[model samples]
Target: MKRFLTTGCAAATAIAMTASASVAARTLDPTKAEDALEISKRVQCGVADGVPAVYHWSGKVYSRVEGEPDRHLFNGEGMNIRQCVKITDPKRGTGYRQVSREVMFYLDPETNEVLRTWENPWTGETVKVMHIANDPVNSRPNYPYSEDGKPHQISTLRRQGKWLFMPFEVPLFYHNVLAGDYQDYVGNKYHAMEIFDFAMLADEMLDTKNPTAYPTVSWVRISDWMPWMKMRGRQGQMVFNAMGAKLKSYDELPKVIKDEIALNHPEYNKPPPGDDPRPNETTWTVFKKMVDKEREAAKNNK
Candidate 1:
């Protein structure tokens, strides 16, 4: 099993210096389990009737090798912007929807440049890709609200005015053609597990004075190497440590990132549609799908 590390002292100090007076004024009773859950919900998921928010995150991915110290793989940065909106349709049950769009960038180790285009060894095809995701499914268990149109029940432990560390495991499957003749090609399935440790500030979420002043959250994830790296049969996992804070405006994004987006993917610079369909696709899934489709089209033409 992978181990999750808590936020470093440096990060904690930074938060302390920048935290609002309202945040610093509140006192936490670690023994209050119910309060912990309520705080966790507010930090992880927005409260009912709350405004939409955006979070910006940047971090490094390391290759964790057995018996050897982790090796630096690449840098990553992304944005997750989401909103909770009312849905009048009764059949939906929840009567509210959380629409979101997530985008990630894998940067070159030395130059920190985004790898937007590359050549595929399997098919020798030039590929242009971006890492963006959207999830339109019902809210998760820990979210502030549930699919049944009810609020989440508080059921976790508390520590220092925040919920005790929680663990989340996500299983992902990737399908592709490893190798085969055009007419004899078959799909190959790969499995990976992603685990995360989540924690956040309870006071910020509970603050009604500033609904838009979202709480800060910190997390770490351990998972397999991104398939886009094309490390075929590689032997290592990636460890990602990142911290997120709610953004008041898109302009708050790092100037470097903003410039990059303007030059490379200007379309994504704008906020996502509120009612757009959920995007459950992954980088590997989409790549394999496209490759298979192209091959099939070629075979049919011949």
Candidate 2:
């Protein structure tokens, strides 16, 4: 899929930096109508001056095609698959000094289990990791929505010729900000306003050039994203301030695309768990304990 926004190298870096500084003390308000052109430019790249070309909102990723141009997965400039990104400061007169990466995934391919891992490569940090196995016989074709009326979507393996492509989306909401399906706290029920399975709090990054810069990024994935809001909601109404400010409303997707792919594609999506379990309960418990310990260390700066 080709992203709607087309970016270029220009004075965007400086403007984003200025905006970042300007909004430093202010919390984002979705009700206010911000400048469309200015928000689009700054959100693509964070507050960075004297740099060329920055990524604003979500980054695109190709569905695994060999020898294909890097267009479908990235913006016009052919960048990498970055979910939410922003340029922090200028460096080397080329790239932004600091940036962020937010990745979301459920279940491990080999194990066919729910897997949650959050990491910040800039600081060599791993925020949180969770694993939940999928039930084969009892597995439903659809994911449950949250109690708050928020939608949920699940991506399962789909066979595309010889390879598998896992299609993911928010349950009822197919917007860009929606990270994963909304599930209740108990892991049993669903809620509308529930948060997504992924969130990274206060990650720090350093300048990647000779002259260092100071910048940081905070991220939160609202698990319950509503697609319908686009038609009814105002443009640039929802503002997100993590790496930078991004307009929550996204271009509507075609119904044809949605109908073709139903819940849980069999090809690329991994099948449900089997009776045979090698990594015994004891091993899994130990792994969870270790991961929990790591998360605590990261949080407390220990």
Best prediction by TM-score: 1
RMSD of each: 12.8, 25.1
Model 1 — TM-score against the truth?
0.62
Which of the numbered candidates is closest to the native, going by highest lDDT? 1
Q: Candidate 1 at residue 75, lDDT?
A: 80
**Model 2 segments more than 4 A misplaced:** 1-94, 107-302
In candidate 1 the C-alpha lDDT for residue 14 amounts to 75
Deviation of model 2 at 46, angstroms: 8.4
Name the Cα RMSD for model 2. Answer: 25.1
* Residue 187 of model 2, lDDT score: 33
> How well is each residue in 1-302 modelled by candidate 1, as lDDT tens digits?
12223456667777777675546545434334333444543444444544556678778777786777777766877776566655543432333455565666777667888877755433475656445443332242233344574544444434464534445666766543443344235534545666544454555444444343354445466666556557575566778776666677678877656777677667555544546665554555556676789899999999
Candidate 1, residue 59: the lDDT equals 80
Q: Give the lowest summed-lDDT range of ten residues in model 1.
A: 134-143
For each candidate, the alpha-carbon lDDT, in order, equals 0.56, 0.26
Q: What is the TM-score of each predicted model, taking all chains together?
A: 0.62, 0.16
